[model samples]
Every structure is written in C-alpha cells, then in structure tokens.
Target chain A: MLFLIEDAINGILMGSIYGLTALGLTVIFGVLKVINFAHGSLLMVSMYAAYWTVALTGWHPYLALVIVAPAMFVFGYYLQDIVIKPIFKAEQDVREPITVIIVTTGVWYILDNLTLLLFGPQYRTLQDNPLRGRMLEIGQMLISVPKLWGFAAAVLTASGLYLFFQKTRLGRAVRATSLDRQAASLMGINQYKVYNIAFGIGTATAGIAAVTLVPFYNVFPTVGVLFDIKGFIIVVLGGLGSIGGALLGGIIIGLIESVGPQFMTATWTEAIVYGLFLLVLFVKPSGLFGVRYDW
Target chain B: MTRRHYNKMAAAIVLILAFGLPLVVRSATYLHILVLLYFYAYLTTSWNLVGGFAGVLPLGHAAFVGIGAYTSTILYLQYGISPWIGMLVGGVLASFVGVLIGLPTFKMRGAYFALATLAFAEGIRVMVENIDRLGPFVLNGPRGLQIPPLKLGLGNLVFASKEPYYYIILLMLLAVLALTWVIARSKLGYYLNAGGEEPDAAMALGVNVARSKLTAMAMSSFLTALAGAFYAQFTLYIHPKSVISLDLSFEIAFIALIGGRGSIAGPVLGALLLRPVSDFSRIYFGDTLPGLHLVIFGVVLILVMIFQPRGLQEPLTRAYNRLLDRLAPGQTKELGT
Candidate 1:
C-alpha cells in the first residue's frame, strides 16, 4: 500500500510533464488542425538548447527557459509563416490533414537527424545542476525534488495557458478559429496571424516541458521519438483538441505506466500504457473530461 | 495503329529488357541493388492497395513484415520447412492478423485509423519482443532467429548467386503490377476509391465500406508478408529491428506516396526511382553522416507532399501523352485513363 502511494505520487508528477508535452501537440491540432509530428523534435531542440545553456554558461535550468521559450516561439512562427501558411491558408479536409501530418513527419526527420549530426548519438546528462539528484522524505514516503519542481512548473504554466485562453484577445481569436475556421475568418479574425501565434504558443509549450525534463532525463536526438509516440497517444486519448483532456489523459497514462508494473512484468508496462490508451480510445471516444474542445 | 497496340509493344520491350538485364550487367553490387529495388517495388505496390486505393493510410505496416519474417523463419528453424511453402503459410497467417486488426480499424477514418494502426503495430512489437519470456525456445525475443545457410536449389530457395533473387523479386513485382492493373479497372478498385474519396457517397451507392476496406487490408497484408518471407530467405536472417520497425512502414508508404498514390505505375516507379538514392547513400556516405539518407527522404517526402501532392505520375503521364500526341494526332488514349 505504501509502495502504491509512492507510485501514485510519481505517476502524477511524471503525468504533469506528459500533459505539458501533449499540450503542445493539442494546441497545434486545435489551431492549425494539423497534428504536429515534429512537436517531439521541437522538445528535443529545447532540451539541447537548455543543455548547452547550462553547459556553456553557469545558469539554472529555469533561467535558461527565459532564452529558450521566446527563441522557440520565433522558430515555430517562422515555420508557420514559411511552410505552413501557404498551404494551411486554405481550409483543410480529411486527406489534406494526412498530407500535412506527413509534412511534420518530414520536419521531425530533418530536425532529429540534424541534431544527430551535430550532437552525435551519445546521451548527455546535467551535472552540478540545482535540480539534479536530491529527494525529500515525509515520514516513510520520499519525493524527488526535481520532479516536484517540474510538476509545479507544469501546473503554473498550464494555468497560465488557461488564463491566456480565457482572457486574452489573441487567445480568444485562436479559440474562435479552431471552432470554425471559415466562421472565425468571417468574424474578422486574421486566421493567418492566429495560426502563426498559435503555432508559436504550441512550440513555447514544448520549451516549457523541456526545461522541466532536463533535470532528470538524458538528452539525445532520438529521445523525441518516445515523446512523439506518447504525445500522439495522449492527444488521441484526449480527443484531439481538448486541453483538459490532454492533462487527464496524460495522468491516466502515467498512472497506468506506474501502477501497471506492480502487477505485470516491468518491461510490459510500456505495452500496458499503450493498451490502456487503445482501450480508452475505443471505449470513451469523447475523452474523460470532454469539455470545450479548443478552449 | 491504335495507342493500345503501342502500349503493348512498349510493355513487351520493357519485359524483354528486364529478362535480359542480367546478361548485360554482371556487377554483383548492381544486381544487389536491382534485387532490393524489385523487393521494395513489391512491398510498395502492395502498400498502395490500402493506402492509395482504400485510402486507409496505415503507419504500422511493419507488423506484417515482422510477422511474415518470423513465421517462416521459425517454421524453417524448428520444423525444417522450405521457405517457398513457408512464405505462403506466413502470408496466410499475416492475412489472418490483417482480418483481426482490420475489423476494429475499419470504424476509424483517416488520422484515427493511422494512429490506431500504429498503436496496434507497436503493441505487436512489444509482444513479440517479450514473448520469449514465456518460451525462449520459440520467439527468442531480441536475439532473433538466424536461418542456417543451405545449398542452392529451386525447392530450397537458397541461392549461390544473386540472379535468382533478382529474377524472383522482379517476377513478384510484375505480379503485383498485374494485380494492381486488374484491380484498378475492376469494381473493387472503384469501390475502394469511392469509399476513400467519399464514404457517404459510397455508402449511398450501396458499397459496403467495412467489407471493402477489410478485403483491401487482407490483400495488402498477404502481399507484404510474401515480400517479408522473401526478404528472410534472401538475407538468411530475421530480426525485429530490420523487419518490424516503423522505418520499414514509412519506406513502404512514403515510396508509394512519392511515386504516386492510386495509380498503377506510381508505386513501382516510386520504388524504382527512390530506392537507388537510398541504397547508394547508405552504401557510400552512411558512416560519414548518420541518417543522411533519411534526411534526403524526409526532405523529398515533404517537397512532394507540398509541391507535387499527386506524385511524379502526373507530370510523367502528361509528358507521355504529349509525346504521343506529337507522334500521332488523336492516338494518346491511355490504359488507366
């Protein structure tokens, strides 16, 4: 029972980060209606950026986010401006989404391979970092400091995103565009600008998730492959564009991964998480917290 | 003369060249490349069955490849069965899996189907990776099964030379093309396209969307398994990474997409054109820069999707028709058109 409690705590912590990862993908899908297969690669880019910042100059990981998030937002904005806008300016259909999805897959390969070329395939871990390797114990239960901070950061940013969506004019426009692109444009929302900003925000979320991750995870090019698959599963479970659903789906998946190993073999935990994902997809197609889709 | 007669003559000449190429080119490396090309041609052609015709873009086709590779290898390793027979057995088994997977997946559309299929593929991969725990003697998990080398014979399907593999794969490609040719003109193809292009319209027109999709998936899986079995026998090795990874899935789908989707010549031409670039890049510069070929493929895939969404077939066909029009007025009615 005590072990189960620890698992639950760990699950929630990791799940929050998972939620952050899925949020990037969810926003892209919500705004552009295109699944950003390269979102994981963008996360990889953020981690590498943070790694270099810490390695080159003495700075906290959180301090590095100040540089990273804005840089990433600009990059994503350029991506939308350069490639996505010309294509996405027109309305999308079923087949068009598949084509756009494949384009993101191409983007993934480009970024991932370039990273492999630059950084090599070897893994890097943070050393002497403040968020590295310390734990707190309350009674018989122990909690890792890094994950705790990561979880806090995730919650803070997620709420920040929630408030932005609720209050800001740009955020409102993004929500309107997602609800109906034609109708939104008819209402004087410049979908071109909205798409660009939404993509930027989507990529900024990746930067946020990456900062939270560098404390514990090994940094590598192909590391994004794991998050890519997991993010896609989370997005699907959350019913595509649903924000709260992404969080709930991420938590559910994390819990399954954590608690599943207690009963099954440790290796099968990955499989169990995916299995549960498929189960949710088939059984509850609308998602657990089926709230407003884009908002 | 009619354009039909001209087309038949062109086909016969191409067939003659294919049969006679081994006589003129004796380089083993070139033959190896050619064999690889034909192999991919078969795989991609089969892939277009579901991807292009049925419009269910599966990103998890590697499941069939792994299953086919493992089934025949295991049968040969444990039961001493010839791969010729074992390939057919593997094909049947893969088709069974196809049915099992397709039933639920048919309910999904577009991206949902693609994601679900990918999940299914990953699920199978995880299972295959861990199955050795139950009985290591069978699945062998990660170590993978290796087919012992054997003497060359028609029955054995083992070759002392590369020519046999080349010819066999070419024949398989030709068979697939012929199959595609027949299906393209048949009611099934029309139904597939209709279902893919407009499901509501197809249903209103009395097409059974689920049944047609399942059949296409079954055919596709069977052909993919045959290709997989052939790969095992040709390489004399079977492993999860080579046979089952999503990379294999991407190549099959992307090659078809790059060449042309829903066109008979698209997949073969796509494989023929791009496979050489991939093979040559891997052979020459693979060590110099990791993933150079993949980078090229990714760029090409994006460019093709953005710029040439219909693939190379459109321009090539246009050029062909223009050429025919210049040669003889009003004599350019093509087969597929």
Candidate 2:
C-alpha cells in the first residue's frame, strides 16, 4: 500500500512536469495551428539559460525564472514572425504544411546542435537550492518538495491561463482565432498579432517549466526530445486545442507511467503509454476533448 | 521526349556506370563509401514509398529497421537460420507491424498521423530497452546483438569483402528504384497521390485513403526491414541505439525531403549527396569537435528549407533545362507539350 502510494505521488509529480511541457505545445498548436517541433528545443534552451544564469550571476534557480520567461517569450514571438510567418503566408497546398514542418525541424536540429556546441554535451545541474534535498512525508510516503512546488506552480499557471483566456480581451482574441482564423479576422482582431502573442506565451510557459524542473532533472541538449515526445502525447491525448484536456491528460499519463513500471519494466513504460495513446486514438479519433474541424 | 527514349538512355547510362565504375575505381575506401551510399539510398528510397508518395511522414522508420536487424541477427545466431531466409522473415514481420500501426493511425490527418508514428517508433525503442526475457531468448537489454561470420555465399548473404557488399546494395537500390517506379505509375499510386493531395477529397472519390496509406507503409516497412537485415549482415552488430535512434529516422526523412519528396529521383539524390557529407564529416571533423559536423549539417538543412524548399533536384532540373536552351537555342521548338 505504501509502495502504491509512493508510486502515485511520484506519478503525479512527473505528471505535473508533463503538464507544464504540454501547456506550451498546446498553446502553440491552438493559436498558430502549427506544431512547433522546436518547442522542446526551446525548453532545452531555457534550461540552459537557467543553468547559465545561476552559474554566472549566482542567482537562485527559481528566481532566474523571472529573467528566462520574458526572454523566451520575446524570442518565440520574433521567431514566429521571422521564420513561421512566411510559411503561413504561402499559398495553401500539399506543400505548405511540409514547409512548416521542415523549417521547424531544421530549427530543432539547429538548437540541439547549438546546445551541444555551447554546453559541450556535458550534463549540468543547479546546486543553489537546499530544497533539492528536501522531501515531504505523508503517511509513510515520501514525496520530494520540489515536485510539490512544481505541482503547485503548474496549477497556478494553468489557473492563471484559464482566467486569462476566460476574461481578458487578448485571451478572447486568442480563442476566437483558434476557433476560426477567418472569423476572428472578420471580427477586426488581428490574427497575426494574436499568433505572435500566443506563440510568445507558449514558449514562455516552456521556459517557466524548464526552470522549475531543472532542480530535479539534469540539463542536456537531448533532454528536450524526450519531453517533447511526452508533450506531444499529452496534447494528442487531451484532445488538441483543449487546455483543460492537457491538464487531465498529463495526470493520466503520469499515473500510467508511475503504475506501469510495477507491472512491467520501467523501460517498457513508454511503450505502454504509447499503447494507451494508440488505444485512445482507435476508440476516439478526435481524442478526449477534440472537436472536429472542417479544415 | 518519349518514355522509350528516356528509358533507353537511362538504362544505358546505368549499365555503363555499373559495369565501368568498378574497373576505374579499384580503391577499397571508395568501395566502402559506395556500399554505405547504396545502403542508405536503398533505405531512403524505400522510405519514400510511404513518406514521399503516400505523404504519411513516418518519423520512426528506424524502428522497422531496428526490428529487421535484431530479428535477422537473433535468428542467425540462435537457430542457425540462413540470413537470406531470416531477412525475409524479418521483412514480413516488420510489414505486419507497420500494418498494425497504420490501421489505427491512418484514420487521422497529417499532423496526427505523424505524431502517432513518432510515438510508435519511440515506444518500440523503449520496449526494446526493457524487454528482459522471451522464453529462452533475451534481448540483452540495451547492449545489443552480435552475429559471427557464417561463410560468404548467396544463401548466407554474408560478404567477405566490401566489393561484394557494394554489389549487393547496388542491386538492392536498383530493385527499390524499379519497384518505386512501378508503384508510382500504378492505380495504387493514383490513390496515394490523391490522398496525399487531399484526404477528404480522396475519400469522396471512393478511395480507401486509410487502406492505401497502410499499403504504402507495409511496402516501405518491408523494404526498410530488408535493408536492415543487409546492414546487420554487413556490420555484424545490431543495437537498438544504432538502429532505432531518432537520428536515423530524421536522416531518412531529411534525405527524402532534401532530394525532393514525391519523386523517385529524390531519395536517391538526397542519399547520394547527404550521406557522403555525413560520412566525411564523421571521418574528419567528428574527432575534433564532437558535434560540429551535425551543427554545420543543420545549418545547411535550414538554408535549404528557407531558400529552396522544392529541393535541389527541381532547381537543378530548371537550370539544366535553361542550359539546354542556351546551347541549342534554334533546336528548342517549344520545350514541352
């Protein structure tokens, strides 16, 4: 029973991390209608950013989030403006999506290699926080405090985003565009501006998540690929374009990963998660919360 | 401009290159590079059946390749089954697995299909790493499998020299090219192209879009698996990391894209150009900078996408046609029908 509890706690913690990663991907997909294959790379970049900030400035890793988040947001906004806008402006055909995919994949490769160039493929961890060693004990179960903090932060961020989308004009513009870009344009909302904001916010979320999770996971170039895959799974599972679905999907995948290893080997954990994804896809092609789009 | 004229010219050129090149370049290093080039070209061309022609964009093709390598090597080592026969079994198995993945995922649109394929590929890699026991057989976890030499022969498909491997891969490439050409002109190709252009319209036209994609996937998987078997025989070692890595899948996709997807000539050109760059990079710069070659390669890929997304082949063709016009200005009486 204790073991099960521990696994559940561990699973929830990991799920929080997955949720944070998926949040950025889901936002980008929702607003831009382009899957940013480079989102993971951005997360990787942010992790390095946080690592370097701590290494150079001697700031607390958590405090470095303030610096990295806005920087990532600006970087993401300009990146979309410069790289992604041309593809979107192109005539829609069989090749448009392919062009976007290739461009972003190119960016992914560049960022990955750049990380290798900058960091020399060595693993870096932040040693500033004593919380890295702290854990919370509840009923014979031990849970790391960093994870609890991560979960709290993820919930706060998700809630903040929910409120923003529900209440703010910009948020409504984002929603309107996601629902129908042409319709939103007809409403006098600048679709391109909304895309810029959405992309910025999306990348910023990844940056925030990176800083939060860096204390626990080591920073590396390839680290983003694994998280990116997991984020993709979450985005799909939660039903693309559904923020609420991303949270639910993250928790479910977390539980599966946590409990799966007990029944099978940990290495097979990913397979089982993917098997579940395939199962969900087979049962509901639209995903748990996906609405069928006419396009 | 007739099909017959083009075929004759192509056949004559291929024959000349095949028969004459071996005589001219007797160096073992060049032969080794040729063998590697042919191997990758065969794999990339096979990948084009699904990714290029059908437009499925499988980012996890390396999973099938890994499966083929592991299956053939394991069969050869444990049961003493000749690799020639083992390769067939492995190819069939990979095809079956491809069909399984395709049946469910093919129902979705482009992005979803790509994501599903990527997940499936990564899942296989993870599973291979964790599988502890299979009756009396063990996968050796992450360490991989190694096969001993079993004498060179047609039955064994093992080669004693780089020359034999080179010939074998050349034959494989020719076979794949011919097969791709046939498929490109068939009714199935029509369905694939239609689905790739517009899935909903294809469905409205009474084409089983999912089924067509699955067929292309199965064919591609089988060919990739066969190549994997050939690879294992040549290298005499197989590892999940080596065979099923995301890098391998990306390389396959990159080659197809760079050469020009949806063209028979694309994968060939892509592999021919890119593989040498990769090999040369590894040979020279790899030891000094670790990942510098990849960084440069990434930059080149970016530049290619930004400037010439149609790939090098289209621009080259355009330039060549312009050159022909320049050289034979009076003879060019309306270049095309």
Candidate 3:
C-alpha cells in the first residue's frame, strides 16, 4: 500500500509538469490549427532563460519566471503573426497546411541548434538552491518541496485558464475562434489578435512549467525534445484542442511511466508510453473527455 | 534543334560532368561531398516516391532505413554475408516492415499519419537501443557498430579511396532517377498520382487506394533501405542514433519538400542544392558556431515556406526553359520544321 501510494504521488508530481508543458501546445493548436512542433523548444529556451538569469544574477529560480514567461509569450505571439501568418495567407494548394508542420520543424531546428551554439552541450542546473533536498513527509509519503510547487503551478494555472475561458471576454472569443474561425470572425472577433493572444498565453505556460520543473530536470538544449514528444502524446491523448484533456492525458502517462517499470524492465518504458499513445489513438481518437472534432 | 535535341545535348553535358568532374576534381574531400550528395539524392528521391506522389507524409521512413542498415550489417557481421547480397536481403526486410507500418497508417492521412509513422520510428530507436540481452554479439545498440576493415575490392564494395564511391552512388542515383522517370510515365505513377490527388475518387474509379499506397511504401522503403545499407558501408559504422534518428527523417522530408516533391528531379535538385550549402557552412562557420549551417538552412526553410511553398523545382525548370527560349528561340523549333 505504501509503495503504491508513493508511486502514485511520484506519478502525479511528474504529471503536473507534463500537463503544464502540454497546455500551451493544446491552446496553440486550438486556435491556429497549426501543430507547433516548436513548443517543446520554447519550453527549453525558457528553462535556459531561467537558468541563466539565476546563474548570472544569483536570483531564485522561481523569481526568474516573471522575466522568462513574458519573453516566451511574446516570442510565441510574434512567431504566429510574423512567420505563420504569411503561410496561412497562401492558397491551400500553393501553400500546403502541412507546410506549417515543416515550418515549425524549421523553427524547432533553429531554436534547438541556436541554443546548443550558445550554451554548448553542458546541462545547466540550479545549484545551492533551497529547493534542493527540501521535502515534506506525510505519513510515509515523501514529496519534494519544489515538486509540490510544480503540482501547485499545474493546478493553479489549469484552474486559472479554465476561469479565464469561462469568464473573460478575450478568453471566450479565443474559445469561439477555436470552435469556428469563420463563425467567430463573422461575430466580429479580430481573428488575428485572438490567435496571437492564444498563442502567447499558450507559450507562456511553458515558462511557468519550466520554472517549476528546472529544480528537477536540468536545462539542456535537447531537453525540450523529450518533453515536446511527451507533450505531443499527451495532447493527442487528451484530444487535439482540449486543455483539460492534456492534463488528464499527462497524469495518465505519468502514472504509466512511473509504475510501469515495476511490472517490466526499464527497456520497455518507451514502448509502453508509445504503445499507450497508439492505443489511445486507435480507441478514442477524440480523446477521453474531448468532443469529436465537429468543427 | 528540337526539344529532343536540347534534351540529348543536356544529357550529354550532364553525363560528361557526372563522369568527368570527378577526374578533374582530384581532391578526395570534394569527391566525398559529391558522393554524400548522391546518397542523399537517392534517399530523398525514394522518399518522394511515397511522400510527394502518394501524399502519405511518412515521417517514420528512418525506421525502414535503419532497419535496412542494421539488417545488412548484422547479416555481414554474424552470418559472414557480403554487403552486396546483404543489401538485397535488407531491402526485402524493409519492404516487409514498410507494409506493416503502412497497413494501418495508409487509412489515415496528413499529420495523423505522420504522427503514427513518427511513433513507429521512435519506437524502433528505443527497441534497437535495448538489445543488450540479445547475447554475446555486439550489434552495439546506441554505442553503434564498428565493422572490421575489409579488403579493398569491387566484390567487397569497400574501396581505399573516394573515386569508386562517387561513381557507384552516382550510378545508383541515375538508376533511381531512371526508375522515377519510368514510374512517372507508367501506370503505377498514374495510380499514385490519382490516389494522391483524390483518394475517394480513385477508389470510386477502381484504383485500389490502399494497394497503390502500399506499393509506393514498399518501393520507397526498399530504396531508402538501400541508401542506409550504402551509408553503413561507406561510413563503416552503424549507429541507430545516427541512421534512424528523427533528425535524419526531418532532413529527408525537408530536402524533398524544398526541392519540390513529386517530380522526378525534385529530390535530386534538393540534395544537390542543400549539399553544397551544408558543406560550405560546415567548412567555414562550423568551428566558430557549431550549428551555423543548420541555422542558415532553417532560415532558408522559413524563407522557402514564405516565398515558394510550392517548392523551387517548377520555378527552376520554368526559368531554365525561359533562358533557352531567350538564347535560341528558333533552334528548339527548327528541327521539327
């Protein structure tokens, strides 16, 4: 029972960051209809930003979030407006929508390689931080203090985004655009602004997630590739455009990743994870909680 | 001269260049680049057979390529088979695996299909890296295979220098290009083109969409695997990480796309265009900025996406034809008249 509880807790902790990493990707996909393959790289860059800020100024990792989050948000906002906008403007045949996937792939290569050039191949870590070795125990359950922050960040941001969509005008407009771009535009929504903001907020989640996660995973150029692929699986599992689905999918994947090795050898970890991705894809392409792609 | 005469002249010039340039350019390094250029041309052109003509967007082709590489290498290392024979065995293996990947995936289209294929490719990477329990023979997994240096000869397909490789890869590329030409003019090309253009319509017309796609995948897989086998022999190493990497898949796809996929010469043009850029960048700026070449390539991709997302092949051919028209407007029509 104790081991089970411990595994579940660990799974949930890992799931939080995964969920957070996926939120932006889901949001961007929701409105832009472009699968931003570069999202993982965005998170990677943000983690590095947090790392460098702290490394240079001796600031706490969490304190670096304010600088990094907004920067990432802006970067995503402009990327959609500048590069992606023109592609959308091209004729369907002349500019294949699939080209956007290629374009994001290009962006991914640029960002990943640019970082490698700047940062070299070394993994950057948060050293001498108070989050290190800090843990909370609750009756045989041990949780790292920083990980608790990760869970909190995931929960808070999720709820925050939910409420934003529920209450705010911009959020509803964003949702409306996602539901149907033409219909929403007819209702007089500035389609581009909504897309830009959706993209920005979506990308900002990576920053928040990175801040929470840097304490656990080291900052590296290729780190985003891991999360990006994981985040992609989670997004697909949750449903293409569903935010809550991403969270649910992430937790489910986390649980599997955490407890799967107990039943099998470590070699099967990826097979297990990717197998689940295929399973979900085959069984419920719409995802567990997501509605069928009506639009 | 007529268009046929122009084509013959162009062919003659191209043939002379392909064979003669190596003789003139004695630098082994230059020949090495030319060899790699043709190799990529082979892989990407084969990839375009399925990706461009069939429009399946198979992002997992690296899986087939890697399978071919490892299959041939294992056959050579473990069973004492020559790579020449092993390449054929590898091609057959990749075709089988390609069908497996295509059977379920051909039902899907676009990004979903791309994702499934990517999953299979990544899955292969994971599977190969964990073969420790397979026994005493070191397939090397992630550490990669280091083949014992073989005797330099035609039978072994191992040469002491770059000259033979240049001719071999160039011949292989010409063979693939010929294959592409035949396909373009044949019934299979029409089936693939029809299936790509309108799957439902093709099925309605009795063009077996699934079969067409499966056929393309088989050919594509076989050709790509041959390239992989070639790479393993030339590099004298086989790492799943390098051979089957996602980066290589993306590179193949981009080369095809940027060169204008679906056309016979598109992948060839793509490989030729990017090879020099990559080599130049690596030579000049690679030391100062480890990834400057890819950065430039990335920028080029973005620019291509913006300007000519339709790709450069059509535009390039048009420009070439226009130049011919301007230089000798009467010559092209004079022969027929």
**TM-scores of the models, in the order given:** 0.96, 0.94, 0.94
DockQ ranking of the models: 1, 2, 3
Model 1 lDDT, residue B111, Cα: 66
Model 3: runs farther than 4 Å from truth? A92-96, B133-138, B200-206, B328-337
Candidate 1 yields a Cα-based lDDT of: 0.83
Fnat, 2 decimals, each candidate: 0.54, 0.49, 0.52
Report how far residue A16 has shifted in candidate 2, in Å.
1.1
A best-first ranking of the candidates according to their lDDT comes to: 1, 3, 2
What DockQ does candidate 3 score?
0.55
Task: For candidate 2, list the clashing residue pairs, or say none.
Answer: none
| Decoy 2 TM-score against native | 0.94
Question: lDDT per residue, candidate 1, B1-337, as tens digits?
Answer: 6677666788899999999999988999999899888998899899999999997788888999888888888877788888888888989999998888788777766666777778878887887787774453487776777877765687777888899998999898999889988988889989999998888889998999889989999999999999998898888887777888878888888899999898888888899889998999888877888888788888898888878888888889888777677766766366564
- Deviation from native of the Cα of residue A81 in model 3, angstroms: 0.3
Measured by DockQ, the strongest candidate is: 1
lDDT of each: 0.83, 0.82, 0.83
Interface RMSD, per-candidate values to 1 decimal: 2.7, 2.1, 2.2
Instruction: Give the 10-residue window scoring lowest on summed lDDT in candidate 2 chain A.
Output: A90-99
Cα deviation at A47, candidate 1, in Å, is: 1.3
Task: Please provide, for model 2 over B58-96, each residue's C-alpha lDDT reduced to its tens digit, 9 standing for 90 to 100.
Answer: 889998998888888888888888888888999999999
